[model samples]
Target chain A: MYSSLIITNNIHSWVLSLMPAAVTGITEMMMIAMIYLTVFAVLGLFLVLMERKVAAWFQLRIGPNRVGFFGMFQTIADALKLLSKELTGTDKADKFLYNLAPYFLIISSLMALAVFPFSENLQAFDINIGIFFLIAISSIGVIGVLLGGWSSNNKFALIGAMRSGVQTISYELSVGLSLLTMILLTGSLQLSEIIEVQKSGWLIVQGHIPAVIAFMIYMISGTAETNRAPFDMVEAESELGAGFHTEYSGMKFAYFFLAEFINMFIIAAIGTTVFFGGWLSPFGITESIPWLGVFWFLLKAFALVFLMMWFRWTFPRLRVDQLLTLEWKYLLPINLFNIVLMAIIVWLNFTIQF
Target chain B: MSYFSDIYHGIQTLLTGMGVTGKYFLNSRKGAITQQYPDNRDTLKMFERFRGEVVMPHDENNEHSCTGCQKCEIACPNGSIEIIWDRQVDPETGKKKKMIDKHIYHFGMCTQCGLCVDACPSDAIKWAPNFENAVYDRSQLTRVLNKPGSKVRAGVE
Candidate 1:
């Protein structure tokens, strides 16, 4: 089934064949990086606009509509505003780590984007341990948050960073455990392999209750991991005034902002790929139209993203103690039991595998 | 058993909260409370008594009912209204008939208090609710109520 729809691989080889083998690798790498960066920039603007629009709709207000048609270019105008803004830093701030923080965040998210098997052939790099690589790389962004907050010399920034660090570290465990439960069903760590297994049926449908439970856990922790609302103590702007990136201004702030949206896209993309079946049309409805895979993938991802936005507007921000207790008391214990339950189910070959 | 029920109850409450927002998200057309100001400017109507600004009402003949009493001028808390009165001999009565030469309304300073409207004895001044009062210059904000060469309406002395 997967063999016929491998056009990107062929195009890649054909391009490589035209150039010398030595420079081909470098050229191809540069080409991939350029394309990914372009996608990342456009996607960042779009996600921000979508978030604001969703937020407005929930509050019964019209969001941006003054810029381009339906405020399509509002984010672009915002990007321009950020570009021309003056960079400001605290007088007593450490400059080196402060600057490097944004890069650490952006680079990690970018690296994770490379591993996702969008339409099988559309993947930039198909690593064997794709899920492991994703989990590992995605965690690096929190260090950036930590560094940015601590180096700023602002008390609020430090507190926000520490809160973010704790939230992310704890939530990551739930995210990983939930993913591991799915991994048991799929019998592989590679994202493509995971999606391929879903051809019979999506993992959520195959494993029934456990898969659904894992999915719920994944979504919650993923929200926390991204430091989005309800779990957005990291940048509780109302409380801490811009959180870890409090002192950052101009393009430095934009970098942090854009990286946040990109991280959100990454989490949604992963959720779509793992539980929802990346690039795989529902019930294999559009199976014949190979290019429609991208559409399917984006549709599922955007739906999940919208769900996150809904969560943001509906739930009030939890207190610090409540946030910690919610994780340690509820999600962690549930996830642990869920993993054990999944192990038993898998051992008994109880999954509805096709 | 209570712990399991508690989790179930928690999930139920969360879903209920989501349902409220989801209804709004889906029924946005029915739920939208925003009045798109610029697009609906032509259709937008203000309340008759909104008190956006004070204006001296003039009839089709460009004749007004102002007796130049300076009552509105005296009543204005912000001193936003100025009545420039000119005395002239009436064609019929041949007595000094006090007429308003100009009813200057400085909108920039006016707080839309409706005091001037309330104080007008001849019912000359009233509230106009056309709230889009923005202009490029401060001079444009100070408006003359009477049309040029217009006189007081008959039988309202």
Candidate 2:
């Protein structure tokens, strides 16, 4: 299965052409790690800057335009500043776990980034059970939050970590079920295969009402999973005062911040791949330009990202009880019913295919 | 039924809230109410009645309208005004007259109450709208309203 998918242009093939099989394999692994690391750092900086700009526009303010042309270099400058700051830690805290927590969160997020098919032959890791891999890896991020909070020896951090644990555990259900509903439409867990299935029409279009409902549930749950605003009870500044990573400072603190934006990107990327066609041009107008698939993929992902940003700015944060109520009382039940409705539609052959 | 309606209304309210922000985002360029202060200095305009600082106007001849009445000095609540009047022989009149030696304004201590401006019998001082009053040295804030060698204009008191 993996052999046929290894095309000519990727790093694996390029490295194999240059060296003997044993040497090439090792070198390819190193090269891929370097590439993904660079992507992680670059994406973290870009998404932070994008979030700030979107937030400013929504609030009727011009945000961070002084650092560079339209503040393009602002997050870069911030990352540099964070690098130069002193790394502070709580004196009595569990130093080992505290140090390990940030790495755990960031690594899990970066691992999840592997399965997203950005364009044809562009994915870093195209595992067989791609969506399942993403779902499993994303859940691991909350454990990092838990460790960071509990090990900090601070009540606020502990409370935040506990909230995060509860939120992610509950929301993960809806996130999985919603994708499960779409899986019925595509009938494949492989992301590349999912895109191939959408050759005729996107899942959202083919599956129609049920897919839309699933997408909505997925977005709300995905946002909660990412620990972002409106669903951001974990880091609710009014209550927790910087939350689970509050005791962290400098580059260590930056790891948590960077992981957040990366998680957000992953959420948007999954939404793009599953609902909208991963890299399929709308109406195949740009079918001649295969490279343009990356442009369309990113365009759809960022549109969903912007929608989340819109949600962040527009809505007030939900109370802890309300947050749980929303997930348990509303989202989970609707999600279960939506899955049944989708299964029935698939059974009856009622999906609208163009 | 209420549960279904709750979900319906909840989504409707969320969409309505999004509409408000989306509208502003679309018109953000013109709708942003923030004023970029230093950047817009050239285009910034202050209202006519804005009381920023007390200023004594001197004509091109270096002559002022203050008749050394000492009314403003008496009216100032904070002792921000000091009038040093001395009996001088007026060049034209050749008679001993009360003339201002120094009109010291301790702008650092001024409350901008406009009382000094109001109490000026000859309307000698008025508010200037130049609000940028920062100074590195404390002495820079204490200003002499009358320029060196500036004399009272020859006019009816």
Candidate 3:
């Protein structure tokens, strides 16, 4: 059955080759979608182990070191445990929404994986509106959070859901604005096209002062969107307990947990695509060393993940009011100013040869 | 002032922050702040004054200095001590005497307060450094100090 699908897809690609650019684009997009689902399932396993190890290092303790060599297979064991355990739902919960929330969360975040370019020709989709699709798909995760909280019929869960809703929506503006500056500079929303623009230099270096400011804004906003530490008031143990998924048990809880780590990877992957030049090597170095682009891409993504972990361990959770105020007062204004500065730089083509 | 001065000031602040982190990172490799309990058992050391389980010292002749005076039994606040006596006819004195047949001590109830050791007039008992007293069965914790055939000495009392 799968072999038939692959043959059909290849045939479709060949047929579209004769059409104009528009039909070929649709065929490429379908191939990208198929690859995205397969890669992300494998990536989720690695991410779970990485998050646990990172958490352990920050707290000065050893975590999950018994299953396999250096505890590599610990996540697999945990998944087995979750699978065998009975999933129990609370009597008070909205059963349908409670069960549906995890599926929504996982599907939406996984959808964002479509636009991430792993290498020069490795993108799942080369949509001209890739950034817009990414931002739109990413916000759908908040719907799952809200549903999970509200359906659980738990006060803490509801509060957590509400906090996540407010936090994600607020941070989205700054993240969108920051990416807008990049979109303006590249004059394209397609991730592959953005990489083409960065063939000579990464945006962080080439876009200069405004690019640096935009990168900072993007990092902070992305961290908030993932509900990472300092901004992780939603799942704050002392305050909202386990937050929106408080009533979920066994495999259902595991689904929510898995979605969180996947969300982290998605944020880091998108950030890499935008500011660090996706799969493009700096100064056109990949021409001599073709694999250098993938190496550079992974290096940047992992560094961003490490920074997120560092922020979680280092800072205290912000008070609800403080978090909102920082978003509105500080992040929004700085991002707006950054956009104006970027427009000036692009207009002057300051360092670019027209 | 100038853009170059602003850049220099930023670098100075960054270096100051990095310096503090560098000092602590270098110091951490010397030794961990907490001790590993099971791994370092041989070199495990505690304060000299730490009180552990009580032990009765026996001489080369297998004779303990306890007179069976029942002082420890009385001194124990928790009733953790028991003394059983056997009447024996002394060879030298030609009289029946009460000899300590068994000295049973229930360590499960022992708090290691050192009161019983201080209360004993003969100074036969002292604290032993065997703090790993955990056992599978609670009954095994009630120890019998005096062996089955052992008896108190003659005349020393």
Candidate 4:
């Protein structure tokens, strides 16, 4: 149904008409990079502002209303302030790794952002192994945290890095397994194909209770993966000061901050893609208006992001031991059992659809 | 079984916490716990007994009840109150009486203890709830409680 509205293809052909093949390819890559960079910056600012506003509501206080109408420009102003700040670091720190750490995080998150099929023909990269690439790229951010912490030459930073390593390593299994559970029903790793399968109904509906269970597991692990609150061991300010990025300053610190929100968006976007039908309109209500798929996609993703933010505000930071216990003891076992149960259901051909 | 129960209870409590926060979040405008201080200045009311500052009330006639008693001066723990007195003849009685030349109140030194107000025999002073006491100059804080060209109220001992 969405085949006729192919905008990205048209743009590619238009560019190709004017330039040689290699030059056109290089130009397209540059344009895509610029687009992703802008999206990353805008999403980071918006999410941070949303977080502050959501936090205020939970605490029953008016938050960040003085800068712009409803504090719209608060993060923008904050970004400007961070830009002007001095890039300070420890005198005896490992300068190479410390400088390189934030790029690992930013680049990985930006790379993951490419595979998301925002709408039909709107995706920058449509890799056949899209979900696999996302899962792989997502894990690379932990290296950034590790390098940032280890190279800072501070004990707390190192401890935080270690905690992050342990946390990410364990929780990554849960994220992968949970998504793998859904992969059984969709039977394709390509994000577009997964959404295409969901044209009959969202995976959460078709896969029934097992999908719901997997979604819960995915969300819990996803929050930990992002190093957000309740799983914020990596930046436990009370214990580890500012954690892995403690020594980072100026735009260096901003890079880490922006990468965090972008990572959060990626997590939410993946959940939307796998379970909520990516950019597909609900029951094909707005399927004809293919451009509106971006709207549906963002709406679902932002809803999930809000849910994550709610988890952050409502829940207390998990004690380091409790964090592991919950992941290993509860999420992993349930995830394994759920995966088998899903296999049985799919085998029986008992999947429900609208 | 207890392990399962713990998980159940944990999820229950977590949901309960989220519910509370969610309820507040939805009605945040109504349930806001903080006041916009500068914005709500007109409606911001201090309690009647709120000891914001010390003031000697004067009538429309610009007459005060100080009577140059020096009781407040003695009672002040911080020595914030200073009363300069002069001997004057009562116009009607032709009797020598003590009258205040200047009721100097060093707000900078006053601790809002209300001791001076308590010690005023004629009930000349009381707390004024105008707490916005900031001033650029230190000298500006040392206020003369009694206005210039003002007289003591009649029928005081």
Docking quality band of candidate 1, CAPRI definitions? medium
Residue-level lDDT tens digits of model 3 in A112-168: 876677766555556889898988998999999999999989999999999999999
- Between candidates 3 and 4, which one is better according to lDDT? 4
Can you give the lDDT of residue B97 in candidate 3?
Answer: 74
CA RMSD of all predictions: 4.4, 4.1, 6.7, 3.7
Quote each prediction's TM-score: 0.82, 0.85, 0.75, 0.87
Best by TM-score: 4
lDDT of 3: 0.79
In candidate 1, residue A36 scores what lDDT?
Answer: 88
Select the stronger candidate by TM-score from 1 and 3. Answer: 1
lDDT of each residue in B1-157, candidate 1, tens digit only:
6878888998999999999998888777577889888899998888666878777778899888988999989999989988898889999889988888888999999988888888888898888888888899989999998778888898997
DockQ result, candidate 3 = 0.15
C-alpha lDDT values of all predictions: 0.88, 0.92, 0.79, 0.92
Over B33-127, each residue of candidate 2 has an lDDT whose tens digit, in order, gives 77788999999888899999998999999999999899999999999999988998878879999999999999999999999899888888999
Per-residue lDDT over A1-354 for candidate 1, one digit per residue giving the tens place of the 0 to 100 score: 123345646756787789877987777788778998998899999999999998888888888989999999999999999999998999999989988888998888888899887675677777889889999999999999999999999999999999998999988898888998899988899888898899998988888888899999999999999999999999998999999999999998998999998888899999998898899998888898878888898999999999888889998898889888888989989998998898898899888865
For model 3, the superposed segments whose C-alpha errors exceed 4 Å read A1-35, A289-292, A351-354, B1-132, B143-157
Lowest summed lDDT window (length 10), candidate 2 chain A: A1-10
- lDDT string for model 4 (A259-288, tens) is 999999999999999999999888799878
